[model samples]
Target: MDHFLTFSLLSLLLSFAAAGDFSDDQLIRQVVPEEEQSVNLLNADHHFSLFKAKFGKSYSDEKEHDYRFSVFKANLLRAKRNQLLDPSAEHGVTQFSDLTPTEFKQRYLGLKTPAFLESAQKAPILPTNNLPEDFDWRDKGAVTGVKNQGSCGSCWSFSTTGALEGAHFLATGELISLSEQQLVDCDHECDQDGVCDAGCNGGLMNTAFQYTVKAGGLQLEKDYPYTGRDGKCQFDKNKIAASVANYSVVSVDEDQIAANLVKNGPLAVGINAAWMQTYVKGVSCPYICSKNRLDHGVLLVGYGAAGYAPIRFKEKPYWIIKNSWGESWGEDGYYKICRGQTHDICGVDSMVSTVAAFQSTSE
Candidate 1:
């Protein structure tokens, strides 16, 4: 009887995968009713009591998902953290939030930012010089789609691979889109359930680079297509290619960033996009937005320093950023961060990763 029940569950899961009915987010929605309910309630509720009730239930469900994702993110973050935390480690995490956003802007944007820039300067800046040159940075292209990692919190893999795809083009002049599926399928530094957990929470680009180099490289999308979920590791020897470079970080002011763009190309920067800041629209004014906390990461590609109003945001300059979420998002796969704002809300002065050659030129 027990065996029959196990077989029945397996059959159901297989059927769902075969029919493409189960997506990561969808699976969470199905298993965790509170997520859907919270969104629904948010759209519906007006009174406090109702909101509280709905929020409580949502929180309950979110905890379960968060726990699951935490485990996955932990795996990746832990390794990267260990590397960053190691006293002997060559690289260390830099915190650049101490400088008011205005100071960062004035130094980098060559313009005075809104008063809010003062507060944003306190955010942390990691040590990384991963930004590339303007011509080198490609548009997000046709692959800006966002994928859900399912019960797994392997956002580290998605984020790492996403940046690598861009970095590969900038470095090798190869516009080939590599595979995230390869990392998901092969990386065994963590669990094998296909759900990346604490063993795989958040990862750095370095790990991905190491994996590619050691394993030879990854295949094109067509060769190792994403199943939207993890499966048995199927290594296709023919899919191998050249390896990528080991990434490094560099911190710069907003002015330095613009100067770098004029001299080099694009760069990757980390920003704090807390839960509330998830809404990307209606952010015309910096402080006006409800959420002031940051928690997300993005890449800065170019700066609009053309006319009399060379900068964006009234008194501050703006830098163009490429995001992972396909072209459907943020000013067509791009958005502008008010450089040198009062508090670095947009990460005006942050860490970026680019090729060593590009770094030498920028310096």
Candidate 2:
């Protein structure tokens, strides 16, 4: 009986491993249409190799969670499909791959731009205020994460809607996961494709905020779901909110961040994703993510000095940030950038508007 029980346990472990199993070929076949499978196999292999080199050893039994497996498989499938659909697409591999390994290291992990140097030179000095200890802003409610605009380069829209959704909740005391699709379709104030111009480049959140406020707020996600690339402007009046305030940026230091912890809630800030190494908990620097350009934006919620070093909590010390890349990625729907780096790369010192009377008075 004892032998049988041990064998059963071993078999269970084996089945679990096999259930999560996948290979480069299988991923390619699953993602790429049959017609283009052969033509894209090499590219698929190259992408797979790169992914393995970067993250293969990182995943072990101890860290094997269902979501982790799902993300891995999903990303692999995405890469395969991307390769087939846009074989000539230079952004994913060449754009990022062409970088000399050294350049890649410098771009992602090393901090080239001096921290707070640019902001300090221009912005007026403001008193450092901490977030409220019991601030309910972070708990406003769940936000639906979004997919990367991919080569479309509509990060500005995502950032704008992400911040606006939170601000809307903070002001109204009701959480509404608004739609980026509405902004993409209706916002013509910007350039073509409603992507704020098709440079596949970058944009500012301030512009998006202005567009929303002038347009009398936005619609909920249900009314106008994401339809990928830009489509004709469509406004659903019933889904519109009454109003939305202009978003703001704040800068604080360690002490001030702590104080603000007792004052406000989450704050949105531009994160330099160039240095995002493995995001596994307890892992410090030596980042291995791409160094191309810091093209992404995220929210910063709170800060903490708890760990050996301070960690930014989107929900705690880690500021609960909302990512544009759908709910399937990162800590549920967001990612956490480590704080205390003093560079404020994670926008630890940055600020966002809240519903609190204090924030209104300060404004």
Candidate 3:
């Protein structure tokens, strides 16, 4: 039994060493030069295990292994830089150790958010009075679970579903997950007013709202679970579970957006989700992200401060953003963008909208 145990340990060590082109010591030294001897083997083993878990069978393929190793090296450098440059940052970005930059970009950062278009339906101005300094719809039992969009560039659908879910919950007092797949398949075609979502390619929240209004309702996720990839629209009118009365785009004013959140539930918003690919944690701001380049759709859930010692941006105000890249991504499937700016960072104030669901009879 002792010999067998020794053999098993030897095999495991060999397996770990053979997983990469470089020796464990060499691989660790390549990325983390400071701890050449201390972490050389341990870091290598830990990273190899993480990489294998992330890529699964692909980790065994020589070519894929080499490529992912390269990416892993790059990610290590990115993490180190983030730590050195903004060590005091409240939100630190380290959740992407498993995915290569290429995989991360293609899988999560592919949302193509277009410029906000004017909605023909005029919305009544919402009154703003005694808005809280901080708020989160999740606390009100309106937000749903953090979801995964798989390999599809269907962030639009996910954003739509999140917004609708919040609205439905607020209106009915029952929090439920809605279907992004339904929108991915059905919300592509133009609405009565000619507005349309681009399906997996890209889309807008307002257009998705129009599609839902016209379709009469949307199905719960249980009835139409997300498949990631697009397919033929198989929507069944009978399965309709949630419908909105109408939707309205909030003004570009940050204060107004906050007021809308306080009055409404969660919001569907667009922003430049570029730098977020490697973001593990930190208050993402204009320093690392653009304020105008809106490219990804996400749900705006709340706002708060994230601060640590050494104080990079002391008590830095930030918006709590819920993403659809599974809970393993950032801050447990959420991100914090530097907030309180008049113009905002990552265009958070650009294309914000909230739909109003008709109150359920049970409510």
Candidate 4:
């Protein structure tokens, strides 16, 4: 009986090892459409090796997971479908394409649950009007170069700084990149419970704006810089470049959001980024992505129906969003989410905050 049990175990191990073989050329060809399959076997092997190394994948018996790279192949196939479906739609393979969905979300989506309040203080409501068919803050020189947050979940700070930078530009005729690191290290109470912009864990843009007002002002990126990690607050009052007089919570109305985008320069917004994690390009909407529930913060610089290259087959209305994940992602560090209609797109109009910045302000 003991001999039989040992043999059974050995046979099971052998079966698993055989099933884990992702090296079979036929298997690769079966998963990836023949037309899309790489003609060079060596190139395919290189990508597979690099992917395995990057994710620290091992085929050891102790590793109780799909060592066959099934998830990785599925995602690549999904990306291909996304591209083919829209043709002009958004999506492509990047460093993230090789990662399993679970790994991708774990490494990137760090926003905490329980939504933060829109704003602690409220201002008078603003009247709304029809905004132009298209507009971009970058065209007006009110926007700064794209930024990357690295592995840190400091997107709230980046979003806040982008809004303040654009506001300051429109107010002082000067475009300046503010310090996200300052907020990461210093934004007080905001670090509490990770409810709103909690260091690298996550935090709210509204909470961040409030912290900026209390901190007197924020330093320029050139002065404080971003380390993408939590550290001691190195804020220097003298190095303060811009001050937020106050911030307003725009109404949930899409028309108001449009008006605010044109009048206020850029607005910081939160969205449900589940689909955006693997998003390559195209007009993102409720059909293809989740609606309501915002887990990521970004800046809305403009909105229009005109799409960008490769995905510009037709005019589909979308929000011109600026991300801090470097220029390598999306359309040069920018993404176009679907726009228009009454309901909010990914809850973008849900938690919008625009700060009023000035070079000089009285405490």
**Candidate topping TM-score:** 3
**What is the lDDT, from 0 to 100, of the residue 336 in candidate 3?**
79
Alpha-carbon lDDT of model 3: 0.69
Model 2 residue runs over 4 Å out of place are 1-151, 188-201, 252-265, 277-294, 307-320, 346-363
Which portions of model 1 show Cα errors greater than 4 Å?
Answer: 1-136, 139-155, 188-200, 255-266, 275-278, 282-285, 288-295, 306-315, 346-351, 355-363
Instruction: Give the winner by TM-score: 1 or 2.
Output: 2
- Model 4 scores worst on lDDT over the 10 consecutive residues at 23-32
**TM-scores for all predictions:** 0.47, 0.52, 0.78, 0.75
Cα lDDT computed for each candidate against the true fold: 0.39, 0.43, 0.69, 0.70
Model 4, span 1-363: residue lDDT tens? 134533553464355446755322223233334565323333544665676675455666623335444555566665654443234446555556656656665555555555456335554466665568788999999999999888788887888899999999888898888999999898755534455556887777878787888888889898898888899989998888899988887777777878878888799988767556557656664232334446778899998855543333445677889988888777888878776642675677777777788764422
Error of 3 at 87 (Å): 4.7
- Sorted by TM-score (best first), the order is 3, 4, 2, 1
The clash number for model 2 is 38
* lDDT value, candidate 4, whole model: 0.70
Q: Sorted by lDDT, highest first, which candidate order results?
A: 4, 3, 2, 1
Model 3 scores worst on lDDT over the 10 consecutive residues at 32-41
lDDT per residue (tens digit) for residues 128-245 in model 2 = 5433433333554623344454434455566666556555555555655666676666664542324342222344444455566667777776777776566777886655753554
Candidates 1 and 3: which is better by TM-score? 3
